[model samples]
Target: MAKQSTKNKLDTSALRPLLRYAKPHMWLFILSMVFAVITVATTLYAPILVGNAVDLIIAKGLVDFDGIINIIIKLSVTVTVTGIAQWLMSLCTNKITYCVVRDIRNDAFAKLQKLPLSYIDSHPHGDIISRIISDLEQVSDGLLMGFSQLFTGVCTIFGTLGFMLSINVKITLIVVILTPLSLFVARFIAKNTFKLFHQQSVARGDMTSLVEEMTGNQKVVTAFGYQEEAEEQFEEVNLKLQKVGLNATFFSSLTNPCTRFVNNLVYMAVGIVGALSVIKGVGFTVGNLSCFLTYANQYTKPFNEISGVITELQSAFASAKRVFEVIDETEEIPDSSNATVLTSVDGTLDVDNVSFSYVPDVKLIENFNLHVKSGQRTAIVGPTGCGKTTMINLLMRFYDTDSGEIRISGEPIKDCTRDSMRSMYGMVLQETWLKTGTIRENLCYGKPDASEEEMIAAAKSAHCHGFIKRLPKGYDTVISDSYSTISAGQKQLLCIARVMLSLPPMLILDEATSSIDTRTEILVQRAFEKMMQGRTSFIIAHRLSTIKNADTIIVMDSGHIVEQGSHDELMAKNGFYADLYNSQFAVT
Candidate 1:
């Protein structure tokens, strides 16, 4: 079973990974703590100066002008020093926290690149985005606040307690007795609220996912008149989020007041007990009693602040746990240590005795095998869920074969470095992805070092140059997810052009032209023919007509290739391929 964090206890598992990122910044963190200590020391000492001033006024009345001036000057210097120290601590702590957060974000993103697509397919994109962006931000915020306040808060509490004890132990005992009440209140609130905050974080992620899902498919939502339905579904998720958020906030909000009430009781006890001690002539002066009261307030004030911050800390802890879960997922089964870089790829391929399944008990591809000559165009035709794409996945090593080897150019793929092996082929998916950048930048995405002449030639051949030139800024125009400046067909053409520019030794076009018009498909198919010269290509086309002239056609059913031949040969046999081919032209 996958592990889950216990609500109240911080998952040390999560903390260990976070600290791995923080290890390099250890000195900086220690320095921040030192600065915090200095700030707290100077701050606590100022209360002593205040007590001296009060004693000065009480001992000599208004006639003590010189003494009062000296005390004022000392107080001014002390406050100024404390402020400077506090500022320094703030500066160092912020640097340390953000730097640590930066490292964790970088690692989390890098982990995504190395993860298998199966993991991505099973998980929500919005949740992954939340872990990287929103969750990390929450974790960063908690660290920032903690670094700034934790050291100082801790030091002041103990320091003030010590100072109070020296001033009057009897009154200090009253504060000690009452301090547990604040802790208990904080604990009670924390125990109930941590689980709520965790649920709140999950709800927030679900809400982000809802927004992403709706906005990503706004066209479908509008085309089918699903606006009302979409809004209603969204309202359900939003309402759940509101309920979880309200409960979390309400419970956490109680901490401040409850702790403050206990603090007030302690304050009253300090005042009463200290007054009695002074009256009984226990050698506690008015100044000492004044200092003791100040110390008691100082000691307890941190508890209030800490109690308030506990809510944020728990939220951050939950976010950190989520982030670490993604990072800790077993990485794509690593290539062997002896794996060699794939080079001199000739495109000759062999799939030998391969078997696979998405689930252990449900077999998909069973002991399958195939071979293709170098520089040949192979077409794969199959109905949906016939293991067509799964075959491609195995070829690219996005997944491993269950029980056999795939060889490229007489070398086992398992023996080759995955990066070098995968780089040997160019792929175009059914969906097009264009970043928010200028036209030239997107065109140069794969081959950033390609010459302007090569990029322009690729675009012209892919039929994308005309549309790109028509944009308001031409090649320099910036675009985003809305794709306002181009149509879906144009985006696909650009993606094709990107692949053409890379010009790998082999190509895998999985529904590459699905978005284009029939007229445009002709142009793109012609370009594909031109690009296929002297290079091996694998075409997974639903429209069998597109691959009529392919050098070899492999027809698949379930997980096995049922027939193999050219169009005329398959038609002569009148097998499954022929029936499938004929069915496409049949009237309903």
Candidate 2:
């Protein structure tokens, strides 16, 4: 089947990358293998000692008691040493497995930092998280099983076979011939199960994404009475996951029982053939036949173990492929080696002949141009679907333009290192992000070294100081994005305070005060006036009342700037800007 072929190809491809992670701990791997050899050799030798004790009993009265006593002592010592070797092998394998998993997790997280924001925006946060957490955990389980069982199982198989061959060639031949049947059964089931397990893993990721989406936006779902719809969506994904999971489980479970049946047949044949050889009075004595039968059982035991491991390995390979996908994505374009780092930025911005789109053939911003002198306040106003946020993204170089040049203080941004260029501006967006930390930590995020006096001043200016003092621990109270105690307005004010603390040369405020009450908005707007006095500022406002004092207001429609002027001039023109401004303030 096409699925089986795909499974094989992916297994081979995924293995190389995994081995590269394991190669760093090759010494541990080699030590585990050495212990496995010692464990298997002693275990096989114990059965031969038992056979020798049986042969020592010639008759009840004439038995060699000393010989039997010596064999018992040897057997006891052999079993104890085997247990110690097995314990050491397990310890080494465990170390190697966790070490490799830790390395993989570290690499995956580092790769995410280098990935383009576009890649993150396009994928589900929960799915990416699943690959790094749940999927990697699956890989860890698989690796542990592999190292613990695979090496020991392999050594046991060959060790048992050699012992059997030395005892009697014909009986050994019977086992070798029948052995392929077990392999065939195991391979046939494993081939079909790999694709099913892969599907199950993907389905689980989808379910995780849906759960994250609903939980993160529970307020929206509750406000709109969308609980029923959300439940229906969750049930649909849950059913699909259950179906694929059951199919994969059913197929993999068949591998063990089916192989055991074939192995049981091999055991029965060896028993009958060896019993006949003993009755024929051949050179093969009772002890030799018993030893050969013991070897036959031990030989076939690994087939059962390895088949189970193959089932587990298939799932591991599938999960590993998902983790690798994130690590292998093309990262953001690196800054040129010779890129200059801007210092003492003057805040002059020039955007000339710029064009861009998130998707090809659906242009968003085209041939846009603008120039802002240092210390001037420019306002950009547009309808909801217009490219207001896209313009901000371009200025920050979150996504590169298709064709254009944006220069800051006469230096093209593309030629400036992203860190230096972004450092020149303080930004506050409509969406607020607060990490899980104390209020003081969040306030001082942009300026870690800001003094307590400076942080208090910024918070007071943003009008969030009164609320911060009311919390249980004042500034020391810990909070996160899901901290239910904080209102949306307070979160926005905290973000504004964060930007004020940094005091960068330029500012980008995109609907920055949308959540604040009208009374607080007036106070914050006055504070913003003082902050923007000499800093070049870009303000994107839906409320026309907020940007009335802007020296230049650029009105955009469908990516092109239709009008650019002072507020009074745009009002006099009675054109698109006038219509947009009036539409917001006119009495209903």
Per-model CA lDDT versus the true structure = 0.86, 0.92
Residues 1-588, candidate 1, lDDT per residue (tens digit)? 122345534546556776787789888878877887888888888888778777777543454678878988988998898898888888888888899889888889999998988999888898889888998898998787777777788888888888888777777888988987998899779767767877887888888888888898898999999999999999998999899989988999999899999999898888888888889878877777788888888889988877766767777777888888888888998889999898779999999999999889998998888999999999999899999999999999888888999999999998899989988999988878989888889889888999989999999989989988888888888976466568888889989999999999999999999999999899999999999998999999999899999999999998998999998999999999999999999999
C-alpha RMSD between model 1 and the true structure: 2.4
lDDT of 2 by residue, 145-239 (tens): 99999999999988888888888889899999998889889988987787888898899899889999999999999999999999999999999
Best TM-score goes to which candidate? 2
TM-score of each: 0.95, 0.97
**Global CA lDDT computed for model 2:** 0.92
Clashing pairs in 2: none
Give the Å shift of residue 370 in candidate 2.
0.4
TM-score of 1: 0.95
